[model samples]
Target chain A: MPEPLPDEGPPSDLVSDVFARDCTSRSAFEDVTAKWASLTLLALHEGGYRFNALRRRVEGVSEKMLSQTLQALERDGFLTREVVTAIPPRVEYALTPLGQRVAGRLRALADLLEEAAPEVERAREEHPGRAR
Target chain B: MPEPLPDEGPPSDLVSDVFARDCTSRSAFEDVTAKWASLTLLALHEGGYRFNALRRRVEGVSEKMLSQTLQALERDGFLTREVVTAIPPRVEYALTPLGQRVAGRLRALADLLEEAAPEVERAREEHPGRAR
Candidate 1:
């Protein structure tokens, strides 16, 4: 009877409000912020990578997880996956311009967290429940 | 006898490199980027909120998820929880200076996404898999 509901909320012209939970931006936000997705985006920001190489760059991500994350990022227009034809076909992933902008913000966040890691560790030590 | 293993990897004095699988900053980076944690931090950035208020502000967060997120943020020194004695005891949550700084970066990210939402929507529509 109705077009399949996309996730949640009534479709609105304004899809930019993430705090609303019903907005499409919220779904996009979740896609971007998903742990593996964020890391994959960051890894690709360095340059294009073939699938296995990208997975290696992210360290702990499994093949299945990295595949799914790349698919999702590609769907959201954050990246492009190209099939390079050679002796053997290879799939390479790279950030689109939009993705590069998004990765820049993520990089800033990562830089802050890296610099603050020691302070965070001190706080972890003082947490009431972390006595062990 | 040996000490307990954390979520993963070996302990290191250098905790700031998130790109390294063993660095503790990756764990902290995961903590900050987790969906609910990022939203909760942003909500608190506007001002403090009682637990219920925060749950409401975050839109769809379940009580249990909010509690866990708050606890983690508190442990990381990103926020504080205080009990106010009144007619009924109430707990309030607010970002610490550290959390404020983190939230500023997150806010910048959010702003970029919000502004870029239209283009992302266009990309989503044109994605090869979206022919449905």
Candidate 2:
């Protein structure tokens, strides 16, 4: 068998291990990777948006899901919620520097997948069990 | 307010829309971003691994979860499952080129979060409701 890659496993040098169940990073990472959460972060990457506007930008997210996602992203310091004093108080969400960085990485991943999706669709049609 | 980002909202330029609820890419992206699924892909990026060996590499995943993750990834054409006929059939899992590309993106994301975990931890400590 070929030799395993040099970075086969995470080097112990890093202080945090995301694969570890108890790592606090896992909590924040999950909140970011959660479907709605990542999409919300990406939406905010564009610019600030009021809650309903963000829902529209995200395409199909419901009010409650987007609300919870924003709260989680806010708690992780990925985004900020600012309430503008207005007729009913306009609440806008935008990415913080950390959130911007996170969104950048997510955007890259999303871009890659979106480009490869057609190939993946073809793969699905050929999937062995698809005929079963 | 600063001019909104030119790239705001998916640009309407990509061939596929990952944010759209019915998009095929959404299904594949969700599978990849799922916690255990992502960790498994990362582990295989090192090289091929048998089922139990992979379980150990991922640290905290249960066998059932790992099995399901592998199936999802395989179905999406991100990996290949091989059965080596030995005294007892040995099953090995490895990433296809597509899987490799996916893992590369995931590792970048994972590395970023790993580096940022301490900051996130500090944020968690300061989360508004932590005092409640």
Candidate 3:
């Protein structure tokens, strides 16, 4: 058998382990890049919005998933949520500056992806073996 | 209670649903950013590596998770795994050209993240409320 790979799992006590070996960065990347998360972050980063406005801006997102995504992002400190104690209890969500920074990076990635997506499609069409 | 966010879920028959809502993208993001996956992809993207070489390059990853990530990436058509019939069964892993493209985007993101990480830290330190 071949030799085993080095094993540096995430530090158990570090919250940022998500970015570390065994934590959730993998998952986080998946999350942040998702259609809704990306669009939502983009929308919010453009300007703070209330919950419904976010839904409208994102086009297609379920209440459960959006709530879940927002909660996760909030937990990760990517966005901030402020609940206004009103008769109807209004809540506003916006990117933290940290979130804004990440969103900027993600937006750049998205732009690049969008530009390359057509080429990727052509490549896949030309060489089926290159893509699934 | 406030009106809930809209409930647009994933399309039932879409393959790239990972990039859509209500699919594995959230989970996938969580996975890709996970320490091993990122490093592994980075290491592999730099060149190519065998299973053992990848293990060493990534630092810390369990055999199972690595296998899972490889399989997932392969299914998504990111990396290609080649098995050369040999004593003890030798397998090599390399990024597909498509993978190379994605990795380039990811690397750009990683670089941006690395640069912004310090700024984020300083911001958090300056304003405790901004971070978790």
Candidate 4:
């Protein structure tokens, strides 16, 4: 008898290719790297936090945007949203293992940017036309 | 004189903080990670490319979008633009040292996502309500 068919797997050709115009990976890349998403992931990297605490730590995210950002990250498997029964029905957000990995890498990038901030500012000064 | 007043450095407090809502680095982070910008940086990471070639390589970017993205990257000191004196005044774009550093990190994140694509798709399948 023929060997049992392999269980369901992502299509053999389903390689994530951001270079491809129609690749779904492009959307994944965007979801992961969007401004708020990156900040949210970094914020959660430290530890789980209640929604309001997360909002405060993330600095500028409004209530609606934070809610949407967390939901999107959770949907992408980068985070988990756990609701605990209590007086206020507390909600905590934390990174999944996958999210931790991404967040680690993002932190490295963020560190590099911080270290190079002085240089970047100088570049802006030199190119006044591009300064925001 | 006392150390010549340390010759014009970025303000001591001018740190790049993506977590800060009002931080200018927030703008820089956005410029770096925007969809087309990320893809464009990855495309140029391989090597320099002419205007039309770059537009093609980045896959889905419109001509105007590519131009604007390239300008933003150039202004950020992450890349440079050169206009060759030719019959058609050929233009080229390439990553600067700073850009190379960023591209390297971004590439790692991109690779991680590609490797995790199977899992992410699985998550979407399990959470049909969130599937886009």
lDDT of each: 0.86, 0.83, 0.63, 0.83
Kindly report the docking quality category of candidate 4: medium
Model 1 TM-score is 0.87
Please report the candidate that would top DockQ against the real structure: 4
Write the residue-wise lDDT of candidate 1 on B23-114 in tens digits: 65788888888979889988998999999999999999999999989998898889999999998999999999989999999888888888
> Can you write out model 2's per-residue Cα lDDT over B4-25, one digit (the tens) per residue?
8686666645568778878877
The true-versus-predicted C-alpha distance at residue B44 of model 3, in Å, is 1.7
A22-71 per-residue lDDT for model 2 (tens digits): 77666666778887887887778889998888999888788898888888
Tens digits of per-residue lDDT, candidate 1, A1-132, equal: 878869877575654777987665677778888989888878887899999998888998999999889889999899999999987889989999999998988888888989988888899988886531
- Encode model 4's per-residue lDDT on B62-105: one tens digit a residue: 99999888888888899998889999789889999999998998
- Please count the clashing residue pairs in each candidate, in the order shown: 0, 0, 21, 0
lDDT for model 4 comes to: 0.83
lDDT winner between candidates 1 and 4: 1
**Candidate 2: segments with Cα more than 4 A from true spot:** A1-14, A130-132, B1-14, B130-132
DockQ of candidate 2, scored on C-alphas against the true complex (2 decimals): 0.51
Q: On DockQ, who's better, 3 or 4?
A: 4
TM-score of chain B of each: 0.85, 0.85, 0.68, 0.86
Which portions of model 4 show Cα errors greater than 4 Å?
Answer: A1-14, A128-130, B1-15
Minimum summed lDDT over a 10-residue window in model 3 chain B is located at B16-25
Candidate 4 chain B weakest ten by summed lDDT? B1-10
On DockQ, the stronger of 1 and 2 is 1
User: Cα deviation of B24 in candidate 4 (Å)?
Assistant: 3.9
